[model samples]
Target: TKMDKHNLTVLNEFILMGITDRPELQAPLFGLFLIVYMISVVGNMGIIILTKMDSKLQTPMYFFLRHLAITDLGYSTVVGPKMLVNFVVDENTISYYFCATQLAFFTVFITSELFILSAMSYDRSVAMCNPLLYTVIMSQRTCWMLVAIPYLYRTIVSLLITIKIFNLCFCGYSVIRHFYCDGLPLVSLLCSNTHEIELIILILAAFDFILSLLIVLVSYLLILAAILRMNSAEGRHKAFSTCGSHLTVVVVFYGTLSFMYLQPKSSHSFDTDKMASIFYTLVIPVLNPLIYSLRNKDVKYALHRTLGALCNIFSQSSVYHVFH
Candidate 1:
C-alpha cells in the first residue's frame, strides 16, 4: 500500500510538469510564431482573392487552388491564435472542450487539404495527359464533389474521434506538450488507457498519408510519361512549367506532414517535434500561394492586376486625406 502511494505521487508530479516548460523562451518564440501566423494568413487570403479576381485563372488548376487556400486558411486559424495566447498566459493551459474543438477543426482542415492536393494532382494529370477531355472530365460537378468529400468525411470522423477521446476520463494530466492539442501528443499525457484512441490515429493517419501519397504518385507518374512524349521542346517546357507549382507545393506539404505523423509517437523529440509541427501547421500555408504565384504565368498576371488595384486604392485614400 505504501509503495502504491509513492508510485502514484511520482506519476502525478511528472504529469504536472508535462513537457518541460521554457518560460524564459516564451517571448522570443511568441515573436517568431506571430510572424509566421501573419504570413500564412495574408498569403492564403491573397491566393483566394487572386483566384477570384482573375478571369484568366478560371481553369481547373485555379479551381482546386482556391479550395486549397480555403483549407490552409482554416488550418492556420485553428492552431495559430491559441499558440499566441499561450505566450501571455502563465498556465499555458487548455480546457477539455476547447482542446477538443481545436483538434476537430485542425483535423478537418488538414485532411481536407491533403485530399484537395490530390484532387489538384488529378487535374494536372488530365490537363497534361488527356488534354482533349480536360474540360469534360474535370467539370464543375466533379470538382465540387472532390472538394466536398474531405469536408464531409472529416466532419463525421473528427466529431466521433473527439467524442471518444473526451469520454475517456482524463483524471490524469492536462498540460499539453506542443502549443496546440495535437491528438497523439495529448494522448501521451493521459494515464488512463488510451491505446484505442492512439490506434485509431495511426490507422487513419496511414490512410490519409500513405493512401493519398500512392494516388498522387500514380497520377504524377502518368503525367511525367506524357510530358516526356511531347516532341516540341517548347511544348514540353510549357507543360512541365505549368505543373511546377503543384509539384513544389505537394512535395513540401506532404514531406512535412509525413515527417510529423509517419513516425512512432514515442520517438517524437519535443524540440524537434515542435519545429516539424510548425512546418506543416504554419509554414506550408504561407509558402503555397507564393509557390503557385511565382511559378505560374496566369497567377503572376493576376497578381500584377491585384497590385495595380491595391495601389490605386492607396493613392485615392492619400488624396482624400490631403483634401480633408
Candidate 2:
C-alpha cells in the first residue's frame, strides 16, 4: 500500500471498465469510434487550414472559429484515442499520473470551447446589432486577447482542480466504470470524504455554465431584436443565416453538457453518463465543422478555392513530369 503524507493509501493505476466488457461489442465499438475520431480530426483540421488560407475569413467570427476548431481537435484527441485503444486491447489500464494529466487537459479544452462559444455569440451580437462598428470593436488584437483569456483561465482552474482532487486518497476500488478519467468517476472512486470537493466542483461548474449561457442567451435576444428591425428581407435572411449554425452548435453542446453535469450526484448513473459523454466527446466534434462548412457560404467557398488551387498545382506538376 502506498502511503501519502496523510498516511492514506493511494492507488498507482486504475482499470477502466469502459462502456462494455462484452467481446461482441468491442469490435463494433472500435470501428464506430475510429470513424468518428477520423472525421473529427480531418474536419477540424480542414476548418483551421481553410480559415488561415482564406483572407476573407480573417474576421472575428472565424478567428474564434479557428481557435474553437483547435480546441475541439485537442479535446477529441485527448479522449478518443485512449478510449479507442481500450476497445481493442485486452488490458484497459491507465497509470494514475496519466489519468490526472488526461483530466487536466480535458478540463482545459472543454472549458476553452465553452468560452469560445460565448465569444462567438458576442461576435454575432456585435455584427448584427452594430454592423458599422464591428471592425473597430473586434480588432485583431482584441480577437487574440479574447481567445487567449479562456485558455489562461481554464488552465489555472484545471490545475487547481486536478491537484486538489488527486490529493484525495483512493480506496481499494481501482476500476473506473467510465472509459476516461472523468471528474465524477474519479470522485466516486475516492475513499475519503468528498463533500468539500463536490461542493467546489458544483460551484465552479454552475458558475461556468451560467456565465456562458447568459452570454449566449443575451446575445441572441439582442440579435433577434436587431433582425426584427431590419428593413430588407435579404438583410434579415443574411443575419439569420450567419447565426443559425452557431445557435445549433450551442444548443447541442450545452444540452449534452448540462445533462451530464447538472443533476444531483445521488442520481448519477454511469451508463447514462457515458452516453452523454459520447455525444459531446465524439458526436459534437464531428458535427461542428460540418455545421459550419455546410451552412456558411464563406467556408464552402474557401474550401472550394483551396481544393481547386491544390488540384491545379498537382496538374501542373504532372504536366512537367510528362515533358521531362
Poorest stretch of ten by lDDT in candidate 1: 9-18
The residue-by-residue lDDT of candidate 1 on 1-324, one tens digit each, is 012222332222111122236777878878987898898888889889888888887887898999999999998898888778777776656666678888899988998888999999898999888889989999989998988877899899888888877666553445566778778766766555788988898788788887778878988999999988989999988888888888899999888877776667688777677878778888888899889877777888888988998999999999999999
lDDT of 2 at 187: 88
Q: Tell me each candidate's RMSD, in Å, in order.
A: 3.9, 2.3
Q: Clash totals for all models, in order?
A: 0, 0
User: Who wins the lDDT comparison?
Assistant: 2
lDDT of each: 0.80, 0.91
Q: What are the runs in model 2 whose C-alpha is more than 4 Å off?
A: 1-9
Q: Report lDDT (Cα) of residue 157, candidate 1.
A: 84
Using all chains and alpha carbons, the TM-scores for the candidates as numbered come to 0.88, 0.96
Candidate 1 structure, TM-score to reference: 0.88
